[model samples]
Target: MSKENKHITVFEHESLRTDRGEQRLTNGQLEALQLFYGENGVPYYSLIHHGVRFNEYVGVIQVGKTVIEVLPKADKSNDADRWRNVLINMLHAVGIFDIHAPSNSNLRLRSNSILDLYFELFIKEVEYLLHRGLVKKYRKTEGNRTALKGSIQFAKHISQNLVHQERFYVRHTTYDKEHDIHAILYKALKLLSYINTNVQLNSRLGALLLDFPELYDIKITEALFDKIALDRKTEPYRNALEIAKLILLNYHPDVNRGTNNVLALMFDMNVLWEQFVYVSLRRHKANATSIAAQNTKNFWKPLSGYRSKMKPDIVLNKDTEDCVVLDTKWKNLNGYNPSPEDLRQMFVYMKYYGAKKVALVYPGSENRNQSGQYYDHSSQDSKHLSNEECSVISIGVEKDVKAWQKIIHENISNWCQLQEIV
Candidate 1:
């Protein structure tokens, strides 16, 4: 496969080379990156620099026909499994996966194939849904003699041949285990079955195949999922449906499409990082104020009315006033100072929100081993408000949820001072 056709970036793996080394990004590729910059709630990206060195994220980003390859951070193993767990928890906190759904945090998928991991999560979820029994609906049934299961339509039967069989329109609610959901699952499974390249993928597919019935591989689309509905009785299927939806949505055939053409899938780490913090804070806040992500509000407006609105990442509201506005940056800001643009943006947030405190949070650099610091910028921003304070807080990414949860809780509580509860 041509380098342009297949761009590879794995978390912690050494960056791969294309025919041309470090080629300039195409206009389309830049546009794709921008689209990830915000359009969707999830932007999978970090800045190009971690400290002073270059550190791009991993994944294949597609814009037009061009593919942008980003390698993940080098660490002990790709730890893709662990990252997925992080993503799952993040998603759970963000309200994507069901809170009650079983998590695979304990199960680490031992494969480098992104497709394999995705397929594994998806198929397993489908099995769970199927095991719970596929949802059933009542539809009009005609023809077939002997069961007399539903109400017979005598009028239409009289128009047809003499009655040896009952011509009926009936409602049957039973788990037939055949539906569009299964059709989509079957189609995805069929795609997985043809792969011979990855042993893990092929083996996993083989194992899954035994469990799934021989269903026709039908053409599946997002609309297929839209057509199905889950009621209170089949509420358990929502989690599985979510998993299946992701798989089918991103499933693209790696057809080795000529040298220049490509098939790619990627996520913006920016969105992921923002959501991680916002949701975590919302989940475990010491204050009772409202926590909002990307709240829409204007900061500066001209007399002619060319509105310049500011969108802060996270805001904490008390009563009717904005108490704290926090902006999350996915950078290792252990020793570095905040950029002019960043400080300015936070200034706008504090000024507009009338917030007493604002924070610029970053991930602590791994090698630095430096403890997080608090720089009181209250005096610095006195021009805006003498009492206003801006702090730079860094928190380590803990492997344990409870530990991480505590870390997040303590860090937030440390920054906030709430009034006594009446």
Candidate 2:
């Protein structure tokens, strides 16, 4: 079967759809759809024009050739009342739901929409912590501490008496009226305030200061110092200082610390795979109408001397006759611009595959002509095509989990334009 032979379709409420039609589905799109359906308990199906076999399950769909799985409605709730619960869970699972919500209704509705109930639950837990005192209280009599040593002795006596006295007698005689609920309330408020402030600081770094007061204060001081150092650098530091800002400005420290801990605990391969599929599908939706792939053994024979056997990410079939060869890189491409070597590798891929356009997509960047287009260079080596023969493009992955779908779609659109695939 040729690359153009596989097709998969999903109806809004249908169990699944698979047909070996002329239309081809991009790997990314297929993966995203599968994930969406699988998560929703919808049946998933796929058919390849070639004789490839696939494994299927109740909420999982896999493409035989690519081993791509889709989970539909992973976070969507069939129950209206349970919408918030399901949405919040989904948001957390995808790491896209924001923590800030002004009201319970807002939180509940947004959580349901995003399928992130855990986040809402975390928020509720924080609210509970804020209202409740951290320490337990006990009562003492008015003359309980009259004499220093005698009071101690008397207190001990009372303690024992309390343990053995009948329940009603102990309640009437031993309860202390002078106990300060106001003071306890004040202390609880302070603790809650500190937690709210610090959880925001910790989210970006993926770690939090211990609840010990002295330790937390010390850590905050040290972080401020590091931020100053980072500010002096010529280039912006995306990982450390910026992330610190994100946590401090966006997350509640005490609440977010617990949230991060929970997220770390729940991280798994299935989650990661779903994320990958989501990103890929989003890109495809943004870029091309349809995409297909062809595996060619000894495909690099044309450029054997210059490059090794390499599997192209996808062979895109656009409206134009010129094919687009795409390669997806799961790395940060923004830090360094593509080097001459990078350009050369892409050029080789294009020439070998007979693709007029080529794209090298990094995980989270967009394809833009930051540097001007490469001009074809005439080399004495007859096998090498001039630079003008192929166009190499770079794209970034979407950082916002919520915007993954949109970002991917936009990127794919831009990528197709760059390659003139559309």
lDDT score of residue 176 within candidate 1: 59
Query: What digit string (tens of lDDT, one per residue) describes model 1 on residues 1-422?
Result: 54333333344223222223344444334334433443453334432321111233445444333444444332344565565555455544655434233564222456344444454566566656556666654444355344656555666555563655444433344455566656666766765465323445566578767777677666667777787777796677665566556655654443333222222345455666688787677666645557789987866778895898778888777325537888887666547788878877787777788886788877663322222223445656533444445677777666676567567656765666544211
Residues 1-422, model 2: lDDT tens digits? 43422323221132332334433445443444444334443222333333223222212122222112222222223343232232233445455443332355234323211112332334333333333322323454333332332133445456655664432222122432122322322332233333332233224212211231221112233444354432232122222223233333322222322211100011122334335434455344424445654334353345346543565556665334566666554434445666677677667766676775776554433444332345535655566544543333444333354465555546555655643322
Candidate 1's clash total is: 11
Q: Which ten residues in a row have the lowest lDDT in candidate 1?
A: 46-55
> Candidates' TM-scores?
0.64, 0.30
Q: Of the candidates shown, which would achieve the greatest lDDT relative to the real structure? A: 1
Candidate 1 Cα errors over 4 Å, as ranges: 1-15, 19-108, 111-116, 139-175, 195-204, 216-218, 254-265, 287-289, 298-309, 319-322, 366-387, 419-422
lDDT of 2 at 169: 20
Q: Show how many residue pairs clash in every candidate, following the order shown.
A: 11, 52
lDDT value, residue 3 of candidate 2: 42
